[model samples]
Target: MRTTKHRLAVVTTALLAAVGVVAGPSSGATRPGDPAPPRPVTQNAVSDSFSDTYADPSVIRGKDGWWYTYATSDPLVSGGTPGLMHMARTKDWSSFEYLGTVFSDATRPTWATRTSGLWAPDVRKIGDRYVMYFTVTDSTQHPQGDDSAIGAATAPTPAGPWTATDGPVVPPRAAPGGGWWWTFDPSGFTDVDGQRYLYYGSYFGGIWVTKVADDGLTAVGEPVRVAVDNRYEGAYVVRRDGWYVLMASAANCCAGPSTGYSVFAGRSRSPMGPFVDAEGTSLDTSAVGGTIALTQNGNRFVGVGHHAVVTDSTGADFVVYHGIDRHDPWLAEPFGINRRPMLADRLDWVDGFPRARAGAGPSDTPQPGPTLGSSLGITPEDPAAGGFTGMRVGPRDRLGGATGLVRGTASTRRAAPAGDVHVRLDVRGDKPLRVTLGRAPGVTVTVDPRGRTLGMSTSGAGRPLRDSTALPRTSGWQTLTVRATDGQVRASLSEDDLHDPYAEVTLERDRLRVGSAPVRLSSGGTVVDNVVVTPAAQDARELAPVPQAGALITGEEFDDASTPALTWVRENPQARVEDGQLRWPVEGTDLTGGGNQAGLLLHDAPDDGDWIAQTKVHLDLGSDEIRNYQQAGLVAHATDDDFARLGTVAIWNTRQTEFGREVAAAPDGRTSYGGALVGTAAPTMWLRLAHHRTAEGEHLYRAGTSRDGRTWTWGATWALGAGTEPRIGLYSHGGASPAAVASFDHLRFYRTRWPSDPGAG
Candidate 1:
């Protein structure tokens, strides 16, 4: 729903691939240009929805022991009208009672257009009063269209009878080219040294952290850019273990099912300057770096981002954010708007990194709720500090003296009762290390640094071993956690404290024996330190398997000549279908921005139900060179100005699968366009657009792309208005520079299985 900065920069493939799961390690391990290790998947984060359509939520616990939440101006229920702002509070976090809007008609700010939106509310306790900072979508001071700015308000209680300042707290920044930079998503932070700061801005101008004056209303000194533009937004900062971590949401925040909106993190020792990812890559680079914080697993929920972190009574953190259920994506009746329900999940600190649901992404299952002074029927174990007897102490010279054993050192610790146990330790060196969790016949997990691999083997015969070459490079210290639960041993290795495990492996029971077993560590040539063994809590539940695709409705072979006239309508006679292929030459025309001269070969979409439209296209616009925007693929067109296009396009140095949309701008009759990235692109890529119609007629089109045409990666969905009927089409446009042609293999349609309520836990 928040569609500002429609022309934001594109995220490069190098940045996106940083979190992607590849087959194995890079061909050249020691090469400086080697790709980062594939991140391991963590699942089973139980989440419950509190309020529907509560986008960009900010939450804080009041002195009264109730957690109060504030959300961007949106309807709280289906077919409901939006308020000035939405607020709710819950003592237990399970049930919520709406406390009504933060601003009444008489108290709402009026320095902008009468229809200006108030969004992304951030509340903090300042001095003796609670202060809230929010985004003003337009400002009379900036007159030139959507010049959003940060506005501050004050109240005595969480459910505030608030009062806004005389003017914008952080005024709109004028862009050099005209209009204003996106000064949105206002968040407040107070450094350890008692210096207050205000974090604001979006993908348009990058996320910036600025010093706050004593009043907490106006900014002082210079603003520091913590994250680069076009990649991160909704900046939230937390200070932990002498590090200032910047967490932000990436991708389109409102793209229905295609909403790949997820949270990422970077940390720096100082409150500002040089925040980097686990690989020490700066967040302000073209090849941007960010540890994956919260991403969508293949589940009912997508677009899980724009979050707020609140610590419960027991000192555990919970991430309160918004997500759209793929099945029921929109608000009830007039359903073009995305229905982003407020959700909360446990936030765990594995090492020093923040992982939502221990890196499980979003959950659709019933999970152990947050600990608020009372036990959640689960008891957390305190890890043993130090308990190991040295066997063969390693070389004292090459291996620096760390707490744990180093190369050539061997040690064993007495294990606790069977049930479930977890061993956490840090490893270093360029050699391999062996860890035996239980006993001699227990699970043996090996960490190989030079090879960038993780191997697991059980002592029992006929029990197959498992290995993963996707382990992060171990030039520095890495955290390794091995867990044994119910006869299953799982091992995960993290690159650094700021990341989730980059590699993971699980081994089933073989000659495995649990009970009063012993834990052994053999640092073959590697170094191990900070050993901690504890009882693991089996609180996480396994998620149900992802639902499979339903029946195929139609599979167009693109071979018949008369089908182009009977089944498809060519907007222009610039393309031809011959020999089971639709050949459309690359055109110099375009459909993005203010241009709309692209040719379209259209086919009427399903008139009644939800369906999927898929096409395989071969368009090679050579990479590492500027091809401008030459692209060709599938399109769901409503008009020249209203459409959703999915194409493999050459954007600057990289080729990307872009799912972009254009729609008529409200109030102003011009068209506004913005693009969200999908998966990595290949010369021949399979693209699919899954379309669903709401009861009120809005169309939701989700984008999916595959490099091999089998394993598909679905991304953010763009919503089209119900004013016109959109026809599925194929198009070729953008400057046809370094000339290329696009050949479409076929067009297929499939029926979908609609879930009654996918978000219901």
Candidate 2:
């Protein structure tokens, strides 16, 4: 089988070279890049930050709960003076507050005089003070390894005022047992016993560890060689589960796309002894190194290396590093390689191995923001279980796979991690408004422009309860407020009247609602600016409640930068995250060869029982109206020869057609397309495939399509004759426009009952 390509994707100029297209399940034809069963991507994918860039980053979570990132001086690129470490802070990795440089160039020590410049640096918290470890060379040589030294500086807080040692803290080792010796990049380690140590070195010399004094200004013990991973630098040590994971950067870091830089790792029982990869090859014995922690994933992040790890209040870890930009990758004059911006991704320990999302590396997809948005503002009676609390959908996107709304309310109901949910929603539209709530185990009160309406509902613990009411129809910007407390709900269309005596009503439980926009009308879906669920005893914003293990499922909205629990695999580098959607363009040569299928597959074990995979897909024809049998939607594949497909399309004879493929019995199957074609005004199709066991004991698959994410119109069902479980994939193909511009607005997988809601504009 052809191996999966998770790194750089070679753009083949041979378009026609990849021939043949599978017209339907009734045919045995296959697409290009479909030779192998793509591996699942459990990879914590990430993308460039919002208009921020930095190099050689050292990230850490301070004792104060905020995350800080310190970087080496980029005078070579930013035309700034040396000795200035750039800094930034973030509550959630999604948004950051840039704090400029840490110290002035005047803080440069006289002993360290490397003309080429200061290299990798690290920061640590020692005895309530911030201690930063850095490396510098005194010579202007080609390789700045020899004559290099690791130094230290201290400050009261992470934002230092001014403090630099007179010389290199850890100078050259005279009689060190070694293979190769070059000193740079000092990774600091605060041992379990509160003692500070450092791992420093580079190139052929090998990495060594040394204990430092309590002051962090001098080395107290002799250096010893630990790992000699080939050409590795930027040594970092992570102690977890009684194992020391040594992660370092490998390969040439700055030759543009030709740069071979990637992150490799090894583990050991003790801090200074031997560490090795899965094969038991000691990092000190072999130059090739141990297991890999991060690598290139072609979608745009290239030459991913030089990284550091930090943890959230919940102890969830994320790695920050700099990587080459696939789009504008070029050596920008004297700055070495430009566009290598700071990128990050969450890390997970699978079967004892610390891996990037699904064992993959840096991805270009927009990931979910770290859920650490706010600290608990209050204390709670029940312990917080970070479950699938709620979701925020933006304009121009589908509801993903939301199922829980029945009747008018929603099926899903969850309590505040601390208190009641106080919803303050900002909305704008001219059409009449309809809101659907799937959870209302109690009474619900609604207010519209006409009058006040009330409904009583009952939902068992974790069951579905639906409720609906007309929202006050208003044009222009306005605020809709809802506050639930003790089965009583106080809601209003105006923020000023939320708590007014007349605006108060009663609701059984807290429920989330959906709008009625078709396609992003101006700004579609619903934008949530302030969704703070309050706590009665204390604020839930300050509480750093850890997430339950089961909440880390394979459901991806392409909105957060995190590793999903399920493995997601990409077949080629043609996929990307843009405008908050997972998009795969059909450039004539897709994963389905000359046909209309290019997709990324999720390797979810079918043995996990029955499931429903759903997503929102749309084809962009620009101003040109679609004319061909444009197809795009969900694909379920068991092997190279079997699978099922469902989505929205314009066929040779229909409009927004319900198009699908059923390849159950090998080379011969059947074709199913939706009969009702949606209007072209707004063309986002919500599609789902539910796998169930029939009375005959056969695992039957049912396909459905929706104009909106809620209600579903069930379509054809096919019996399985191939593999027991199939992989879920998202594909885009065959639009009259050769661009094959199809986009998946959102994707989610559910193993339970489906909920329906009203369609949004």
Candidate 3:
């Protein structure tokens, strides 16, 4: 038996290698280094937004050039309703318009009543009719141990008057040993050979595949184990480039922002059994797989899994899934309410395996759209444009005093103006206090009572702007100037301040305001004030990349002098380029001194997933005594309040630690419960971190790492919140004091798809 097992592993490795693929590190596949392919632009292409609550999303492209996405509703509100499946339509992945719930009813199913949420529904076009396959439970009981069954519905279009069958398509059964009752998270697929198969199972049994009858409503054969052997659930499948790809969800899910769920994948010649990792390890059917396919970054939140894969009008594959919101603080409650939203992201084959970019979250690049169009005047409920409330004293009364204030609305709007714009506000104060304008990218400008003097502070790597200019201040109103250019921005109190010989204040791009709560006076005073904002344009160059981006070395061809010191260029002549990738071949040198670091250092002071960052890491020394935290990974969406770090940590000799981690809001920059993992291992690695928005909440994920850049090992997974995006970078800590140098190279950043789901094998 041992010899046979060895032979099977060899054969599997050879077959995978011939396909130019390897098992992920944990799965024993070759490490992969290829970047995700750029998405083809299309008309009406829409990207996922922070407000979407898509989960277990199944997408399909119609013959009509329209793409439809079906997902579960907010689990918190669907009370006892078989988790209503919702729908959205889009031409491109760029944007989507919500359709409505696909499945909801006054009555419930027999096996699972209205209490058990409907879960993991998959949609496929069977002939001219659209068939939807899903799972529903018989009880709202905890631990999810009750009997579950697979059901189906049909509709003419993606948005359905979905009609359900009288009974489940696949009924629950006892496992071989009565270990646990078997249920389903049904997934459907059509192989190149015209074979129709349905994959289903949950934590009770590994994913099982069985042929579906031509009618598409019943199983044609007994179920056979296919992809995993452990505690895996939520199986999905898609065929690309002649290979049958299987994706599955591994780990705990459905706990709101604190859940631990991620997507994993494998391939097989047939839809059954012996699906191997890149390195030829059999997927554990009963335990979480050790390979991670997609995860969240800084702005992106929630652990994304339980997905459905579908092709778009152009035939590009896309994954749809739900994630929690990073900005919605309410999701922080344990066992309280779940608010994950459905999201979608494009997927592609890299070296014959499926890969997806991190989904959009609160902290990634803002999708290019019309900045919050024309403002509709201020209201007490507007987050960006509103007045103060709940203050011990108002802005004017507490001139030199301090008080508490909360941002009125939970949202923000962008301002549009013609030229250099001036923002004015009404003040009622006599003491000295500084007025500050807040903006994204952490931009801030402070104006003092001596209107002639202005000071500025930015989170990125730009010089501070300080100048003196006269400003208009009446007993009732005060106005401040904010300069705007194509990309850069400069602020001064007046024309006199702009002309000051020493006043060479220049900021990048037009001015934007950071949405802060109502301004306060000093600690023990009262004040009342109304903020008035306006915009004008000025001549200037585009704003430079924020100090965060500039501080790190991306590709070998890019560098900036004005960038900050978080990253540096080393002097190793041996560091050369290979196949358009940077390679460091030198050995045995203590290059850990300041400025000699191998990877980029990020100092943007963590924010959320509105930003994303990537860099390659190479480590030479391996030590069993090395601290478990000694590893190289990506740091993103970091703030003084909350942050997430994802990457590979070489633990003790036993295993390599894959970090899919998050730091939630804590009193002193610590997580309320510490970080969690999607999976772990000890090996050379490649890591990606992302934040995504969903109906339930914001989510974060971390894909595993590998050596030869082909295979990988699953890592950590965690949640940040909802509606908030943050910052990103590369991080290395807790190893040797003079930490063994970890070389990072070939970094890039791009906008990712939202509500990304993992496809099935």
lDDT of all predictions: 0.66, 0.49, 0.46
- What candidate 1 gets wrong by more than 4 Å, as runs, is 1-51, 278-281, 287-289, 333-335, 349-353, 374-761
Q: Order the candidates by lDDT, highest first.
A: 1, 2, 3
* Tens-digit per-residue lDDT, 369-426, candidate 1: 5432311111111112234555333333222242344545454444443435556665
Which tens-of-lDDT digit does each residue in 172-257 have in candidate 3? 66567553455668877654333567888865666788888755788887778774433467877654333456777765565444
Error of 3 at 684 (Å): 11
Prediction RMSDs, each to the true structure:
16.0, 27.3, 27.2
Best by lDDT: 1
Question: Any residue pairs clashing in model 1, and if so which?
Answer: 42-360, 258-715, 258-716, 258-717, 259-716, 259-717, 394-408, 394-409, 460-511
Q: With candidate 3 superimposed using the best TM-score fit, by how many Å does residue 636's alpha carbon deviate from the native? A: 14
After superposition, the stretches of candidate 3 with alpha carbons farther than 4 Å from their true spots are: 1-52, 73-83, 92-99, 107-111, 139-145, 176-179, 229-231, 255-260, 285-292, 329-335, 358-363, 366-761
Using TM-score, give the best candidate's number. Answer: 1
Task: Give the TM-score (vs. native) of candidate 2.
Answer: 0.44
